[model samples]
Target: MEDELEDRVLHQTYLSFMKIVTRLTSSAPHDTPVSYLWKMVRLYFLRSEVAVITLGIILFIMYLQTIEQWSRTLLSRLSQAMSPISSVQRMKFMEGSEADKQSWELKGSLSAAYAIKGRRMHMEDRFIINENINNTGISLFAIFDGHGGEFAANYAKDHLIQNLYNKIVEIDAFKEGKIISTPTKDNAEDKPQEPESNTSVERKISFKKSVSTADDTSKKEVTDPELLAQLSKARPIITREVRPTKPIKNVPVPLSSYLDKGKINFGKLLTDEVLAADRLLVEAAKRSMNVAGTTALLAIMEGNHLIVANVGDSRGVMCDSRGNAIPVSFDHKPQQVREQKRIEAAGGYIAFNGVWRVAGILATSRAMGDYPLKDKKFVIADPDILTFNLNDHKPMFLVLASDGLWDTFSNEEAVKFIKERLDEPDYGAKSLTLQAYYRGSVDNITVLVINFLDNKVASSATQ
Candidate 1:
């Protein structure tokens, strides 16, 4: 039994020794070729992942920097574009106006030309107003072009309509006062007193007057009662003579009647007001350092009457029911022969190859402001106002736009485009302006399209 226990203990010791050898071989570090290849492969993958993460971080930072730079550039461009008309300005008479009582609706759009580089720039400005009073609707459209700088254009855009409003008010006041009669030394004393309120004044006198006169100076020859019997026997040899008649004198009608009869005297009013305003604008322009000036085209539609006032090169186009564009405003520039002749007659010489410049200072013969050239006697700074009554058909659309769009498209072309787009279901004024910008208009383009469609149609179309 002792021998059997010894054999079993020895077998146990041998098995324990073999287990210790196996553990030592497994724990020992090995440098076998296969193990080294596996370690190399694992390290290579880790390095690649770290490299990709580092590259991704770098790209993200670059993207952020690029975005920041791009934002700054865009903001700078916008700022430069708006630099010219940054000054504070006010309109002359936009306040205290009654809203339109009519049911008509008005809509408009505007755009700037393409971006320009450096000091030279192109810009546009526009204004529109709709007024309804006593169920009568009035719409006003205006465009202004800034030369030398956009300050003048902006000023005109903000104020020209107000000036027209003031002029209209003046006209209303004149009509209310019955001041149509020419002031004479004798009638001056008999003139009616000014009424406290405009509406309280007496109705204006009839423009026409009738004249009647009678005189009993002479009669046909007649024989006396005693001689009548003798004359009858004498074969009635007496003859009768009559004096020649003279024309009766009639009183002249009052001038205001012409205006009251739907004849808008825009020419007279614009002549008076624009000249005065031109003088003021010239003075103000002189005070400014950059010699700012504006080109203006203004239009007013009242009933069938269309009044147009223009200065410089801006334009007003009228589209009839047939979709034909009619130019209402005349462009005033040095290149016009009549303007050139006027300039030459006034002792002003044309420079730059007969461009009709005033002392070689200005390119336009007629403009609102250019104090440097104002001293020239021949320079026409006053606006030309033209008025006409439309045929029974109302205007389909009236376009008031800056020169940016006009430079590329003629009045007819613009009207045609607007008309064609009008029929499209999704057409919009803003979209048309954007398309203009896309069509190579490199300046600030502003367009005001007045559609006289019904409210429901306009609302639906806009939607």
Candidate 2:
């Protein structure tokens, strides 16, 4: 009805204007030029009620057209801003000095960690410890040594584990503690296996023998804790070299019987979880996390199974009952053959600047942020995951630390130091961190020690 009325009104107004124009032109021969213009206006434009409706409708139409154009423009801009392909928001550097003067500590009945600024002016290191995940007998521990800034470390400290857990419980089997049984030999292909090598070191559980990876170490098993401690103090001190090898991909080791009261997948889907967490960080690094990067080492202990995922040069080593060190995770350095190949494949290069560095900037070839390199595929956040049955090592405790500690302390030296201080007030975490600082580590120092004594762990807060 309104449309019809509007059309009729416009049509009548058009006919009226033509009629008035024809009349004025014919009648204007008797009037002056100025008077003729006034007569034409009075006949149509100033025609009172009809003229008001016609002018009002025309003005309203103009307003509607303007609003329609504005709405379309706004919608188009919004679509471009929100589209994934068209949008690449960048992170901005913060103002003022973020260089920190800080030292920190975290202590629990079963775990403890310590950190300090060391020789660096800024403290860009972060750590996390969640002794129990939803009371499911699962514990989480991590250390992130950040570079460029603290943003990436902070982001991972806050979100990494949450991301891992969300990925873990996605399946009903894991959620209900009804994970499927281990695959049979006939179907062993269901899980990928490590490339076989005769030199592979397989850990075994025996308190009578301390598991040692050194080829030159004595074969005799030391049962006396006191004697082992005595010999550890007298043993030659050396940094253990990390040789990256293909990770063992299968094992629902029979040790699971005593490790847990309930059956849950033994770190199943953990690799996917680590990859998922890094993927998220990469996106954040590209957008808001800035160009900052961090070395991430996360350890999950469920029952007797200990699974570790690592990136960058941060280190993790487990001490056996006999006080020897067994590495749980290997470092990813640019000089590694595989790492060099990947960098070369991506059209990037590494250089030695005091230490081997990726593109002469980052010391490690793998990290959680470092957008400058991650974007170029020279540095990655993909974790090299390794799993171990704590039962096999007859483990005493685990020491996970940043490269800052590794810079000053070797695997053998650190294991011996911590084993001697495990019963101290800080459980060796604080002592080891101070030791690294005194030994002249140039980077930020962080150390985490987790004790497996009595099969007990705790949920603790960082201080």
Candidate 3:
């Protein structure tokens, strides 16, 4: 009886072990050979509760890590995409119409337009139109094409005019054989002009603003008459009839030196102001931790002089009435001999990814900001200045545009294109920008079209 009871207990224990194996194997997947292997694993682990718990913890940790990495990647991409959109919203007013169809006239001579955004979210370009500067028949128009960011371009548009105006004021005072006044922040606006003749009646110079709307929107001409009138109202008049009781101190410079038409070195003056602007922009960018730069192409039309200044690849072209295309500014590129030499001297290398670029990053050797490359001095902000006496040539109009328009269109081609649509300055610029876009230009485009034929002084130079 004792042997039979011992045998019965052993049989019951074996039955309990078999029942656990059957339950675990029943739940195991068996759809393929791999599933058969899974079944074997389930059987082995079923015998030990600790082994199963260990595997469950390992899988849970892996799943959490995968979720965390995926979340991070998604957020990073989303932030990059949305950041440009917010920037776009902040600059809607500055943007040109869809395809840059909108046109506004500056003074009576220049007609300008901004184009549609290319691949960029924002235009990444800014332009300026200040007519009748400093009681002089001078008009200032500029285009700033930005890269990496728009801060540099916008900053230039806002500040370059004032800086240049101050410089002009100082130079004019020097040319008049007068004592240079202490350069004050607001001197340009307050400085009085010397009398051109001995007339007792002071001549008041004023700019008139006029706006005429046409049936066709493209034909509308917009002028800031109020601004011009205000400038006239602010003109300072000094009584030259009653000489000062105190003897006046005059500059010792020869009268002939001041009388000579070519005495002023405008090119040097322009270069200095452009570099100063770059320094200011670089410092501002550092404070904000923003890395950005811009290509500047500006034109100042004063009397018979047309002064063009450039820092990067944007161009200024003057089309003569004889249909000749005169290049006012040349593109600044990394591969150019002068630029390459400068880059090498500054310990920077030019490499090609799509096109030749400075340090395999920036394409232009000269620009406004690009603070990362500023220390190396490879990418500079100094401008190439060109002075043209508009009277020397039969000037018809001036075309200033970012690289986007020039890359696909040659200088001669652009001149012909504009000449065909010369009747409509706004439409001409817009069409040219669109042409470049359709021709596969992958960058932002901005164009300024100034008609010298409209101004009576310049009309004599026209075809």
Candidate 4:
């Protein structure tokens, strides 16, 4: 019976061991840790969800970085592109218009405009130069517009006013040589008289003296009556017979024909000199091709004189204290009828757009550069200079601006707005620029406002 029990126990233990083996085999295929880890890795990889999630995160980060890099690059490029924006500086003075007549006080403002975008590429625009030399009431103001590029405008801006100043000084020097002379009575009475003393001469002298005395008495009677009557009338009508029967002969000189025949080569030397100067500057500037250009309008107040110079379509408008607008500068464009006619007369043709265009090349009637169109005796770049006399009755303010500002506002509108702002103590060019932007002026806008007041000291004290 004991042996039977041991066998039965051993059988039961064997059955339990089999059941444990079955359970382990169902739960896990392999007993090794490596095999289980390999199974888990295969299942995870097969699902694909974690790998896709990781890849999506990496791509999103890359995209965000790319966007950020692009934004920075674009902003940098835009800023670089606008590197040539112009700057303005101004100076105000305390002086009146006249010296001896100092009833009204004088005040003036001067402004300068400079742009440096493409330093190599010159832009031609308007500029102002004001120089108050001592208290001699000598001042100069000028405007320079560059066409075909900024080089010519800059050259003119630097030199034109100086030349004008020199010319004025030269004129003053020439006027110092006029002298007047007055006649003296002592010099007119120095004369000699003859005396007769011979016997034959004595008889003749007695007769001559009697005749002389009678003639003198008659002359005195005639002179006294005529002088008294002339003085009483206070007006005299003198008539005299004058000879005028000669006809002037006309002689035609064949100077032009002589020049054509090479008899006179004066123009050649002049042309060479001009060409040499022109070439030197062009080569120095590294600008053989006339690719740079600008337009300008400037008004300067020197004492009581208003000088206006224009090179392009930019303009200057003057307004009375009552806000009446007056154009001080003429627009120099080919579209103007008078300018078109002038260009055609100068052996040039106007383009179809009604502008003084050269072979459809330039829009302005006159400009500083455009080497291709510049000819020795035909195409010239002389700007129109005008002058006006400023007086008390015409107390005015001036508006100088770029095309951008003019495009959005009319002369009357600009004057009105400026007049309203003039009362502000700290008003400046920046405020005007902001107003232009607010008015939807998309292009770059610049403005200069000059106020001329009667009471200089009182005006400043009040401010």
Off by over 4 Å in 3: 1-108, 173-180, 184-264, 425-427, 454-463
CA lDDT of each candidate? 0.52, 0.66, 0.66, 0.44
Better of 2 and 3 by TM-score: 3
lDDT (Cα, tens digit) per residue for candidate 2, span 242-262: 223343443432223322444
For residue 217, model 1's alpha carbon misses the true position, in angstroms, by 77
3 or 4, greater by TM-score = 3
105-187: candidate 4 lDDT, tens digit per residue: 11243332221111112223334434342222334433444444345544444333333333233222222322111111111
**Candidate 1 lDDT trough over 10 residues, lowest sum:** 208-217
Residue 28 local lDDT, model 4: 77
Per-residue lDDT tens digits of candidate 3, residues 234-287?
233211122213322332322233224745556666676677667767766665
Task: Give the Cα-based TM-score of candidate 3 against the true structure.
Answer: 0.60
Which candidate would rank higher by lDDT, 1 or 3? 3
Clashing pairs in 3: 209-225
Please list the residue runs of candidate 1 whose C-alpha ends up more than 4 Å from where it truly belongs after superposition: 1-126, 133-136, 158-160, 173-264, 288-290, 352-361, 392-394, 423-428, 452-463
- Tell me how many residue pairs clash in candidate 4: 14
lDDT accuracy of residue 212 in candidate 2: 13
